[model samples]
Target chain A: MSPLSTLTPRTLKKPSPARSRLRGGARYAPTLATVGLFLAMFAVGAGMYPSFLSGQVFLNLFIDNTFLIVLAVGMTFVILTGGIDLSVGAVVALSMMVSATLLQQGWNAGAVIVLVLLIGGGLGLLMGLIIQYFDIQPFIVTLAGMFLARGLCYVISLDSIPVTEGFFTGMAQAQIPLSGDLFVSPGVLLALGIVAIAFFVLHHTRFGRTVYAIGGNEHSAMLMGLPVKSTKILVYALSGLCSAVAGILFSFYSLSGYSLAAQGMELDAIAAVVIGGTLLTGGTGYVLGSVVGVLVLGIVQTFIAYDGTLSSWWTKIVIGGLLLVFILLQRLFARKAG
Target chain B: MKSLLKHRLAWPVIALAALLLLNQIFRPDFLGLRMQDGHLYGSLIDIMRNGAPTILIALGMTLVIATRGIDLSVGAVVAIAGAASCAYIAASPDPGSPVTAATAVLIAVVAGLALGVWNGFLVSTIGVQPIIATLVLMTAGRGVAQLITGGQIISVSNDHYKSIGAGYLFTLPISILITAAVFALAAVLTRRTALGTLIEAVGINPVASRLAGLRARNIIWIVYIFSAVCAAIAGLMISSNVTAADANNAGLYIEMDAILAVVIGGTSLAGGRYTLVGTVVGAFIIQTLTTTVYTLGIPPEVTLVFKALVVITVCLLQAPKARNLLNRLKAAPKPAAKEAAKEKVAI
Candidate 1:
């Protein structure tokens, strides 16, 4: 269906295989830049802090950032479809709140998890329907979704609910030893598993290609007979499902469900995705780049923690600066390619 | 009457009146006005006074949105402005003096202007998407604000400064007066000159506008700067009203509220057309809705749910797809109704 139709070169002439490889490499420029930056920062930390070189410290980054990685994976899907989901952070909180309340009510832990995930996905589906059917702007629709989810959280409980369920607390305390000294939490493993699945789904699936096609040019994708509507809707639903998983991980990490938990966490997930090299305009990025982005963020925080003198606000400044640089690089690359 | 009904602002104005009526039904004395010591007092006045900040911000937002851009950093700008001014006031030799108050206001406005310039540069010069460009400041601005205030809640007992927010002038809140003045200025600047047309041109089609000899970048720059300055002025009012600058909480989610107000006022988010009058009415409607919740004894926290409902409903009503669906439904129902006409006519 496709082999003969693609014979016409996009440019003046078809590129040689090496030239194609070079062009492909250039497309990964932002992700590569992020990877390089992460390494440089790691080197700086290694030179400054003796403990930073420890293998456990590297594992700890995954442990502490488990929820973020999961959320960024979800965000990667939404951004890949040329949409943004501002409701992810709020949905995460809503999931946590529901889970904590249900647990306190003596509901089965597994049942609670499934129900909260469904709730998250349902809310996302509703937003997606509204956004797609009504043709409303994604940001405005997601913004309302954010308000609704956060409001529902307050309605559930204004106070933080401690998740003392036997299953939850047990999972929270459980750790898997990878070697003599290296260990990771159950949540870390769950997050990593999700990332692996996401990497495969995004790269190997037709849905993944459709997402990129839509992002590149939605009208053209529609004309090409792609299931644009359902894909767009499903992307948001996928993001919501991921957010619910992150919420569970977040609750495990903190061992409580606060109404205000994960406030602006969507921004963190987006920042990671952006810094990892996904263009905010959508399409042309890797899930692995996002993982590197999360690692970079974790290292920056660790560096500040080691310094001890810098205030917590420095984290915000550094992240903001990094976002600016990565976005500018993307702009430059886009200019050159276009 | 028909002309009045056809006016662009009719719906928002009617919505505002309906909200007031609803509040009156909840509280019998809701709409009552009283005068004491030559000053007027009423819920109506309170709505205007309390909504001044939102109204001011929404006016600038109208322009920015018209240029097909958004300023997410406005809320952050609010925090920085209040933090800067309050810190300066608290450090002044005479914190309560009028001169000190004037200096504080000037400093805050200047800070806002500078922030606007940064936003404008990022969008216009660096060519960052407006949402992402402003987002950089949105994330970092609070950090800057906390830095200015040294991470403390700065409070000043300055009467002159307080007057800007809480005090009255000619029986009306000074804040209301300030808002009215700014609204007038924006209206004149846009309507009296070619700025409004140029803005709409850029917003409608930047490339075409550029080809047609319009300075799209300058228009984008101006709107962003205007938005930032408006947010700063609103920040001053908020801080001056309470005589305190709480960096963390001041203007939190205000950008959302301002954007909502702008949208509800009949301005399309897609940009091109805007209504300043409608925006003011929208802000007033929002303020009344909040007050109405309090009067009905609904926990104000649930107001977010109500806001979400309102924004979605408004957007849906504005959406062309919704209308298309409505037409399809109508088309489906018409034949069935026509077929039943004989039976109905016999009845």
Candidate 2:
């Protein structure tokens, strides 16, 4: 029997509450915990600030975190396959730089968008191919890719490029009114659309299942005749595509491209994925959970901001603490499952 | 000679020599050194001085990576150590006193030890993956440093403290002497005793080693603490050099450079065998590369690309697949003869 199959109990036995809890809620415990935390934090915020409970305040959370949401969605796929893509942040910066530079040069906005997406996808594909063919560790390969992409960004320009194109600015300003004093921007809508597609693809597609299988056990997946190589590469490609879209959203939000933009964003995305109940070890997670994770992060930042006296650096410390807690929680569930 | 050529240190040593040669070609006086008022003065000395921090960190990283683990928080630890030390000294009534410097160093060392213990607990006791475990501190450490400094850069004007980084000892940079002493101590401790074998055994097969009565957890824990201490000292060197603790930029990306140094020195990230000498060479190579970049008139912003390119080249050269391919090519020209020779040797 394969090592993976050996992980499952072969003998029939009576189930205890602990065992049943391990079998049932273990997979969802982290997500459930995340939801509970978010709600509790929200309650605290609402209690602390009367204005924090408004529809506009919540809408602003989605709008502000749209870029992170999109990035996390892509990161979810990579993490699901037991791989990591540290190049996402660098790719985002590269895309922003490329898009801003092109738009500043009077290039068509549509063409620039397509080109940026292609660049991101191409870079991911290259890194994926290197990882697949050369059998290099994903961490090291992605680290190299991160360096390369960041270097390329500097090669393009060291200074921030302000995007003045009408299409870009208009997209930034475009908003859809929902209720009284509440509205959503195009970036938020795009983020939601990406999340929906990611959810559908992850849940309903053969490729997505293959990705999960690969993460669960690459050797077993290969023995089972899954398209491990292609799926692995495609997972990175999809992540790259998502990063590109997120980069465009970021540009639309900020209307400028700075080389220093999105520094440490990959860590943020990883934190969100972990917080949302997705296992960093891979195999069991949901894209939607990652969305919740992003929201949790956004809410924490919002709370800190609302406090009015806390330093912005507190957000990092809080997030780091949350990441540690969630990781320990995941470890507990994993131990119980085993 | 053939066996010597096959040694792992051969490549890094050769790479370092090649870089020095390149420097020499670019500037004939690159190798020139002179004594001025009892201290050596030259570009070579500068490389040794500047490379000291990296060498110290890489020495610790070598052991961590050898144990099938990594410490991503070392860079952050550097910041924390620097922040703590500098904060102490800056607040001291007499910052220039040796007592203040010694006390500050003690604070930094204690802070590093605490952080290392925390990391060790998370990885060994809690069974957290080393990367994620250290990453927690890596993320929060800078914030802690910022808090220590109250979100401001604290600069010190302590002559004694500055000498730790920039002072000369026996015509050598004090930083270089400190790094060498640490390296020699590590080399003796690991090699003279059974500790090296135990570390290797734990790295190669923890389960088997544990069953064989080795304290894998203790070994892992000690290595992390050692790494953190190394990072702390390196942090002191860095902050002392500049006489300022800018939490935001202190030790920024030094982890990457240290990791690269370890890998370039022929230490596999997968963990197993390691070489301290190779790590030292690797550190020098990296420092030399940075110096070379500036000497070549490359813009500071574009220098990272050059560094990346060189790292990629070195990594590709060291990869197992590339090595196998090269061996195959070497044998292909006389496959029949090579086969006969192999058969004879086997018989």
Candidate 3:
């Protein structure tokens, strides 16, 4: 029997209620917590200024946070496979540059999008191939990928390029009206649709099962003939596609693309995925959890912003602290689970 | 002599010669050694001086990697140490006092030790993977540094601190001497002591090592603490060189370089069988490659792509399967076609 065979049956365990609650914290827990946190902030903001919780204020969250949701979805897929894509932020920068450059040359928006996706996916494919075929460490390979992608972005433009195309600007600025005082941005809907599709694919597809399998035990997955290398490569490619899509959302939101735009956003995506209860070692994660994680992070930042006294560096400190805590929690879980 | 020619170092020695030859052809001025102000001055010396931190990090990384673990937090620890020492100096009444210097060094070392302990505890007792454990510090350590500096770069004009990074000793750069001393100390600690054997045993097979009466956890803890201290020293060098503590960019991406140095030195990431000398040589190779790229007028952006290519090629050459395939291809070309077909189908 294989060394992992002993743990196979136990893998089907229905986590105890408390354990399930911990894992499910990203879903139900985040909602309640976010609501409570939001109300507290809203009350404080109202006390400081009476119109802090206005409809426009609420709409700002969707406008500002839509790109993060898309990025988080891509991160979720990568983490589900027990791998990471540190190069996502770089890919976003690269894709944005590609789109910005192409659009400047009068290429059709559709063509620009296709070009960015193909380039991003091609980079991802190269990274995945190196990592899988050469048996190189994923972290190093992705680190190199990060450098390569970011370098290309710099080579395209050393600084920010304002996206001047009217149609591109209009598409990015387009807003969707909702009932009553609430309005949803098109980017928000796009992010939500991607998340929903990600949920369906992860929970209801054989490919998702293969990802879980690979994360659980690569050797076992190989023995079971589960197309391990192809799965690994495909997930990276998906991550690249997601990054490109997020780049579009970001460009629409900001109407600019800069090489340094997403310098450290990869860390945010990582923290979100981990906070959502995804194991860094792979296996056992949910896309919805990542959405909640991103919201939690976003809300925390909003709270910090409302304070007006804290430096932006506090975001790093808070995320870093929470990351440490979640990692410790994961360690504890692994110890108990082991 | 014949056996020495067959030694592992022979490959790197030959590679170094080839690199020099290539440099002489492309940039002949690179081999032009000279002396200035009673000090040896040349590209080689410049490489050593600038690469002091990397070489120091790689030596410690060698020991850590030997335990089948890595220290991604070293770069962060460097920032933390730099911040700690700088803050201590800036806030002190007598920054030039020996006591202040000692206290600052002590405090920085202690902080780094504490950080390492947290990482070790997570990896050994709490069962977090080494990479993940160190990653926590890798992310948080910078935050701690930022918090220490109050989000500002702290500048110091202390001669004592400056000497550590830029001062001369016996007509040579202090950084070089400090690095050499640390390397020697590491060599003695690993080669002249049983600790080295224990670390190797633990790395090779922790369970077996434990069954054989070794405390693998304690060993891991020691190695982490050691790695952190090395990072502290590097931090001192960096801050002293600039006479200011720039927490934001200090030791950025150093972890990658350290890993690269260790790998190029022929040390396996899978652990066991430490290579102190090889790692030092690897550090030299990386530093030389950087300088070479600059001298060759390659744009800084293309440097990373070039590095990526080099690292991939190195890893492929190191891969056993690749080596076997190479051998098989050389012996019988027919199997190469078959293997290529298999790879295409697999993709």
Residue B90 lDDT, candidate 3, scale 0-100: 92
Q: List candidate 3 stretches off by more than 4 Å.
A: A1-59, B1-13, B96-99, B333-347
Q: Write the per-residue lDDT of candidate 3 for residues B99-211, one digit (tens) a residue.
A: 78778878887987888788778778876788877877787778888989999999987887888898887778899999999999989988999999999998999999999
Pick the DockQ winner.
Answer: 1
Residue-level lDDT of model 2, residues A1-338, one tens digit each, is 55775675656334555676766677888889998998898888899899998888888889998989999999999999999998899899999999999998899999999999998888888878877877777888788888888888898999999999999999999989986767999899889999998889888888989988988999999999999999998888888888899899999999999988898899899999999998888998889899999999999889888888988888878888999999999999999778
Better of 2 and 3 by lDDT: 2
Clashing pairs in 2: none
Candidate 2's DockQ: 0.64
lDDT of 2: 0.90
Q: What share of the true interface contacts does candidate 1 keep?
A: 0.64
lDDT digits (tens) for residues B223-335 of candidate 2: 99999999999999999999999898888888888998999989888888988888988999999999888777787777778777777777778778888989998888898
lDDT of 1 by residue, A1-338 (tens): 46754785667345567787877988988999998998898888889888788889889899999999999999998998889999999999999999999999999999999998899888888988888888899999999999999989988889999999999999899989897978999998899899999988888888989899988899999999999999999998889999999999998988898889999898889999999999889878888999999999999899888899988888888888898888889999998888
Q: Give residue A330's lDDT in candidate 2 (0 to 100).
A: 92
What DockQ class does candidate 1 belong to?
medium
What are the clash counts of all predictions, listed in order? 0, 0, 1
lDDT of each: 0.90, 0.90, 0.81
